[model samples]
Target chain A: MTEKLRIVQMGLGPIGNKVTQYLAERPNLEIVGAIDTDPAKVGQDVGVLAGLAPLGVIVTADIDAALGGGRADVVVLTTASSMAKVHDQLLRILPYGVSVVSSCEELSYPWQTQPELAASIDRAAKKSNAAVLATGVNPGFLMDFLPAAMTGVCRKVRKVTVERIQDATFRRIPFQKKIGAGLTVEEFYKKVEEGVLRHVGLTESMHLIAARLGWQLDKTEDIITPIIAERRVTTDSMVIEAGNVLGVQQLGRGIMGGEEVISLVFRAAIGEPGARDRIVIDGEPAIDSCINGGVNGDVATCAILVNAIPVVAKARPGLRTMADIEPITCW
Target chain B: MTEKLRIVQMGLGPIGNKVTQYLAERPNLEIVGAIDTDPAKVGQDVGVLAGLAPLGVIVTADIDAALGGGRADVVVLTTASSMAKVHDQLLRILPYGVSVVSSCEELSYPWQTQPELAASIDRAAKKSNAAVLATGVNPGFLMDFLPAAMTGVCRKVRKVTVERIQDATFRRIPFQKKIGAGLTVEEFYKKVEEGVLRHVGLTESMHLIAARLGWQLDKTEDIITPIIAERRVTTDSMVIEAGNVLGVQQLGRGIMGGEEVISLVFRAAIGEPGARDRIVIDGEPAIDSCINGGVNGDVATCAILVNAIPVVAKARPGLRTMADIEPITCW
Candidate 1:
């Protein structure tokens, strides 16, 4: 008989619930606890909240109550995209000697942008002998880890470019709204100014690639633009006329030696006919790779978080990134 | 200033020479010693043999002279395809507390085929506190590691298939000849009977995928067939007429519960117009990935071996597979 890994599901959001459902399907994994700050979800059964039959694990707002029992080997954290918001939760979990696999975007590679906080987390994890990681489909795997792994087949790498073009029609309603689908051009600009229309983690992905390739960059830059629907575009819940905004195009560049050596382009719109994920490497033995249809973001996010559990459990104590551990696989 | 990692180049074959060239290009890597059993290569400067400026390191025939100096941090070994042939060399190198990254095919996942010998090597590595790995373009990356990494994006995986189609026209003369590019069907059958016509790593790659996916395969089968030329095909060294053998097609299958769940198809021939590397995963979120041009086997073999030095140098002591350490990246 195989031993089941005990894990706590943090943040009972869509991604968290999906991860719970996946854990339920695996006989080698057991969900022992759940956490959420929402008052209404505090006392609900975790499995029931995830749309599965009750597993008898209750959700709690108290982190200590969920993790302090010493039964949790790992925590699946899907709270927020920013490190500033998730830092406190990580600090509380580390001292319990529980490893964490988070979906926090900025925490994916926070060394450059949040060096002090990263070091602090590293210190806490080391003190308690726990491991911490942040990963997802885009920033964690597609743009950073995938390109870095492809470079293993090249003798010399001059430049690397990755593009993610997604069709947002079948995505969750929240995701469709998050990409600024069916907005006027003027409104799109206003939302960009408010910092709500753009995607996070492009810059983090750039830095992760640079760190793995041993490149010292002069600076990193991100540019966001609106992709307007030229014709009538209809989605699951909305309709946009010609010249209206459909989604956003985000580009991130890492400039080194006065040249952009790493470029990541993300385009998400409602009616993208040729949705795909592509990577191009310019060097000796050049590589041109493509995924015909882009990876499903919400589903993949849940999968990567679950897949990282075993890897994180045995990792050396510290703040770890996707590049710091072995390539994640479904187990 | 960053301290350089000292590496000893062993084997002095085509792949070894290419690895030496790549190592010379990196400022963070230094060639400390070179070893070869060939009389013609012994005493020759490794860099000159690799078609580069002389690096002032002479190739020696004795392994002790190359690794016994205690200056080598790792060894780029490109000696043989079988673990049985390289087991002694590994035993000799591990006791020096020096890590090894070989191009041996069977060593990629030897636990299934050579369990007792693999145990011996593992024990030696642990006793000496050194890490040992075997990797290349086929068994190590494209068929095994690449697909396994892609599965990180899947919620559930039902089947996996990888195909490598190569055009032998631009390859080295030796590789063209080895694929039996200009042989009759009868000659090809004779070579197959002698165990010289089929690719060596299909079964190893199958086991690697099975291990990563946590699948218990009942058995695996490899089938080899000649790809006969329908039209005249010409290469730099030879020409083949219609009805003659142009190359080979090799298929490897992994059966689980009496069903074929893993399939790898490798086809290499002259005048192959659509040469590419592709992977298809059948599951909840289907992934159809393709590399427009197949990864050049020889060059990639060299690149992966050299790129693994720094990673192997810092890994924990044991017999490691591609799944055991962080993914290899050019640094």
Candidate 2:
């Protein structure tokens, strides 16, 4: 019998729970360890924490103990949003020689934003002979990878634009709150200036597309603005009055030689008319594609993380970006 | 300095000419030889044949001379529409240790139609340590590869359907004539029965999708029907009277355990309201995607061939299908 690939779940948040639940059902993948810092979750059954039947494996906070057995081949890390917050944790895990697939938005293309930390991670991964990749739906796949793949049909690509719109009212409470769904416009601007409200990774996506196209971008910009509610909007946990901020409208652009070569627009708001993901490539024989209903973020993020495990395991050992790896597939 | 990848272009048909034109402009790719059977094109400049300025390389009809010098690393073959017609050509090239990327539609997944020939090609490729791949925009990318890639976002895929519609009036005269654009309905049916008309790769696309998803199909079917012209239509050289055939509507389906798991529909006619490509997956969190303004076949086929040259060169030695190779990318 062939040995199943062993996977360690390193976080127990909503997305992490989704990943664990999905991975538990795959016959070829075995969940070997579960780790989290929360006191309540540290001693719970991993399966139960994932809202599934108990699989007999217990969650623990000890990273070294979980990895010391050498049974774990890959770690699905969803503990943080930024690479800075997860840098030390990666340092702790890479030495075990286990590959990692994380959901860190900033880590998706860290070389563009955190060059020093990206190099450090690369060095550590190389020392351990383990490959590392960061990916998610918005920043990694839909807005970046998909656009780059579409350009495969073009003989000469002059411009690429991607637009993603989602109705946040159907999302979870944390996601709703992250978008400042019930805040006043004044407060929304305050949070935006405080660097706590805007969406992350738009600029990272821009840089990624530019690099894939071999364009040396002279300028890259990301701007965020509030999407105000036109009428009363209510979700299961929150209510937004008219004139209050509904969500965010963010745009990122990469300029090269005075031309906007890459552009990404993301909108997550309440009561949007017709949510979809669209990409337009301008060149010889232009292309325009749209997904009538955009991909579900929570589910897609987990699916990509799980699907990427086998890919990362086969990748070259080091810190890798999506562009550096093979085109992602069902395997 | 790194050595450029050497490429040999075979068959200077409409698509082959486009491939040569695109490959000539790439800095990382160098055109080493061009081959065509036409007496008029045998000694002409390859660039002029491609409607471009002179590229110093002349067209040749000598296959041995092209491969004997070891200057060619890959051959882009666009000679025929079926593997049976191109099998000997592939055998000749593979033994030279030069990888091949062909546009033969039936070769896309020959295990379904020509298993014997497929295995022979595989053995030849393995013995020579050379890889062989057959790909085009329709069978290789838009229908099979793209749909398979979209499933990476799903935890479970129950059914997959792809719809591609093209406006044939924009295509070249040969393509327009191939679709029986000026033929009557009776003539179209006769041509279809005679195997002179209809799309070639829908069944291949179905098999490719099934292989990727690991589904054992119990039954597969391909159906063809004429799209009657609603009104009089005229192209650059021909005209179709009202009540005549506009083009062909082809459908292919794969069934497993009495359930239709894979479905493909393609429509290319003289006049259509909208020309786009759409895919729908019925599974957890269903997905609907549409490419508004479908991919241009001529341009995309050339782009895919040129882009796949490097991939085929680096692939495992065998008769590899699109599903067997790494995810198709711009590289």
Candidate 3:
């Protein structure tokens, strides 16, 4: 019998827990270890922490012990959103010669914002002969990779536009609160200026698409605004009065030779009436495609990470982005 | 500079003409020869035949001469719709040690219908160390491949359903006629029973999806019904009375373990009010996605075929399907 691939789940946050739960059920993958900084979760059984029947593997706080313990072919890292916060954590894993697939939004395309750090990660991955990749539904799939793939059907593409509207009512409480729901417009702007109430990585998505299409961008801009609630609304966890901030509406654009070649719009709010994902390409035989309901964040993020494990395992040893990989096949 | 990939265009039908036109514009590909049986088109410049500015290469009727011409690495076959008709043509090209990407619907997945022909093609491809694949917009992408890729985001998929409703008024006259528009119900049924008036390859798509998901289908069914015009409709070519057939509606289902595991519905006719493509997966988190305007067939089919050339050129030797290929990358 072919031996199952061993996987270590790093971090036990909501996304991490979901990834672990899904990975535990795969016949081809075995969850060998789990890590989390939470004292409450450190000693719990991984299966229990993931809300599954006990599978005997335990969560630990020691990253080194988790890495040193037996064989782990890949590590699914969902620790933090930024690469800066996870740089050391990733550095610690590379030496163990285990591939890593993280959910860091900024790491999805780090050439513009964190080139030096990306280079360091590349060197570390090469030295250890391991692959590293960052992916999520928004920056990785919907906005960048999917739009780029759609252009494969075009002979000469003039412009690309992608829009993602998500209703936060069905999401977890943490996500609902992240969009500054229920905050006043002034308060929302203050929080946005303080870096606490804004979506990250739209610029990264623009850069990724531009680079893939071989367009040298003159400039890239990101604009964020508050979507004020017109009517009182209540989600599963929070209540928002009329005139309060419903959520955030963010737009990013990549201008090439004075033309806007790439445009991306992401809106996540409490009371979006019709939430969907749309991509339009203005080229030969213009394409207008819409996904009626946008991808489910928690579920799809976990699914993409788990699905990427096998691809990363077989990938060339280096720090790779979504574009660098061959076609991503689930089967 | 690296040498460009040499390509040969076979069959100057609407799809073939579009493929040639698109490929002529790519920097990495060079059109070396063109072949068609039409007496009027045999000696015309390939570009002019494709309705573009004249290219230097002239169209030819001699298949052997075209195959023997210099450095024809791949042949884009669009001559016939069925594998039985295209098998000899594929055999003739394989011995020339050139890869092929055909738009043949039956060749998409012929294991159930023409297993012997498929095996023979596989043997020929293996002997020549070349790859051959059949793909297009509907059977290849919208119904089969795209849905399978979406399942990557699913942990446990219970059932998959894809619906494509295309507005046929924008389509060409031949396509409108193929759907039996302007014909009475009796005439439409007679043509369908004679195997000349129905959409092809939904069964192949069903088989492809089931195989990718690893489901053993108990039985598969295909149902063809006429989409009678509700109101008087006039396309560019023909006018349909209120009671005449406007187009065709085809439905295919795959039953597995006493349940329908895969369902595909394709409706292409005059005056579809809200034409779109939708896919739903009843699995973890339940995915619902819709493409506002179903894929533009004429343009996308050509683009997909031209895009597939490089993939087929680099693939392992066999009668390969989309499922067997490593993720298909556009750039």
- Model 1, chain B only, scores a TM-score of 0.97
Clashing pairs in 3: A290-B290, A290-B292, A292-B290, A327-B327
Ranking by lDDT: 1, 2, 3
Q: Residue A177: error of model 1 in Å?
A: 0.9
How close to the true structure is residue B222 of candidate 3, measured as C-alpha lDDT? Answer: 93
Please name the candidate that would achieve the greatest TM-score relative to the true structure. 1
- Sorted on DockQ, best first, the list reads 1, 2, 3
Error of 3 at B77 (Å): 2.4
lDDT for A59 in candidate 3 is 91
| lDDT, candidate 2, B89-150, per-residue tens | 98888778999999999999889889999999999999999999999898888998888878
Model 2, A1-331: lDDT tens per residue? 1568899999899999999988998877999999999999998999999999998889999999899979899999999987888889999999999999999999999887899999999999999999999998877888888887777667788999999999887788888889888999999999999999977889888888887676789999898999998889877888899999889999898899999888898999877777999888887669888987789988888988998888788778888887667556554
On lDDT, the candidate that comes out on top is 1
Model 1: clashing residue pairs? none
Task: Give one digit per residue, the lDDT tens place, for model 1 in B122-199.
Answer: 999999999999998988999999998999888788999999999988888788778888999999999999998879
Q: Which residues of candidate 2, in runs, are more than 4 Å off?
A: A1-3, A119-129, A230-236, B1-3, B119-130, B230-236, B313-320, B324-331
Q: On TM-score, who's better, 1 or 2?
A: 1
Q: What is candidate 3's lDDT per residue for B49-158, written digit by digit as tens?
A: 88899889899998889989546999999999989889999988899999999999999988777899999999999999999999888777788877877776666789
Q: State the DockQ of every prediction.
A: 0.84, 0.52, 0.38
